[model samples]
Target chain A: MVNDNILGIIAGILTSLAMLPQLLKVLKEKNVDDLSPLMLITLILGLSLWVWYGVFKRELPIIYSNAFAVLVNLSLLSCYFLYRKSG
Target chain B: MVNDNILGIIAGILTSLAMLPQLLKVLKEKNVDDLSPLMLITLILGLSLWVWYGVFKRELPIIYSNAFAVLVNLSLLSCYFLYRKSG
Candidate 1:
């Protein structure tokens, strides 16, 4: 049980922070042509759902990780639009 | 409880399949220059751990969803390598 909790925590941390690199890359390059807006939109929807699911289940790990993911993806999405518009 | 379960299922489906559009985009365009390999790697690692966490908890939804996510990310990672090498 303890091991499972640790695993969940680690997994949550990794997944939540996974997009940091991509966000940094886009910020550095200011290019969004190859990145798919549909993907980001779908992911954001999914992450939001996960947050709601977590709320229902009272799963803090799921809630926190996915909430953070939502924020990151939202930032990425905004960057996508911001950069795409300028070009 | 049933509503919560349903929410979890839907969330699982959405999050697990979120990368499909991105995968299709990569296949059609053969361009992953904007995608970050580190992000994919981190996501894959996280998904793998989610699978293990699910197994430990005997939660089928978590296991299946994360397993599928791992597959998607792995394919994305392979494409990243395949295209990055050629270009």
Candidate 2:
């Protein structure tokens, strides 16, 4: 990719891996009871909006990256729900 | 604010709060020994560059939100270091 496109790719990678620390923590602990469900929900909703914005602008970089980011967050959310102990 | 502006603000809030779940979990657990330090460092660097990009574009929403985000991540990193035990 070109130099300009490199930023987009970097952004994409950063955005996708941003949650790695939290996901790693959750997995190693085998519990996510303490993770904020509200925070994750807001992220999902907000990033969805960003994806829409990217579509409206016809910006492939933003759209593709945010789309992938959604999957990352969704996976963490799933683990959060799955491993959480009902209290 | 206009609808477009609302999106910017929403994006701002989400960008900042996106890390809340992880921070909350860290505080609750008082441990980030398992969390990916490399992940956090990369995020900080990437977002810093994003901040620079925002400045390059004179995009207040991106710059401002990401500036606050750096603070948020730094706080988390501090907590991570303070509470983490060497094992």
Two-chain DockQ for model 2: 0.45
Alpha-carbon TM-score of each model against the true structure: 0.85, 0.78
When superposed on Cα atoms, how far off is each prediction in RMSD?
A: 2.3, 3.3
lDDT of 1 by residue, B1-77 (tens): 35866776787888767767878888888888766888888889999998998788676777888898898889888
In model 1, the clashing pairs are none
TM for candidate 2 is: 0.78
lDDT: worst 10-residue window of model 2 chain B: B1-10
- Candidate 1's fnat? 0.86
Q: Write out the backbone clash pairs for model 2.
A: none
Worst 10 residues of 1 chain A by lDDT: A1-10
Q: Where does model 1 sit among the CAPRI classes?
A: medium
Here the TM-score of candidate 2's chain B is: 0.82
lDDT of 2 by residue, A1-87 (tens): 235346656866785677666667777888776666788788888787767756664556567877877777888789888988877
Model 2 ranges off by over 4 Å: A1-3, A24-30, B24-30
Chain A TM-score vs. truth, each candidate: 0.88, 0.80
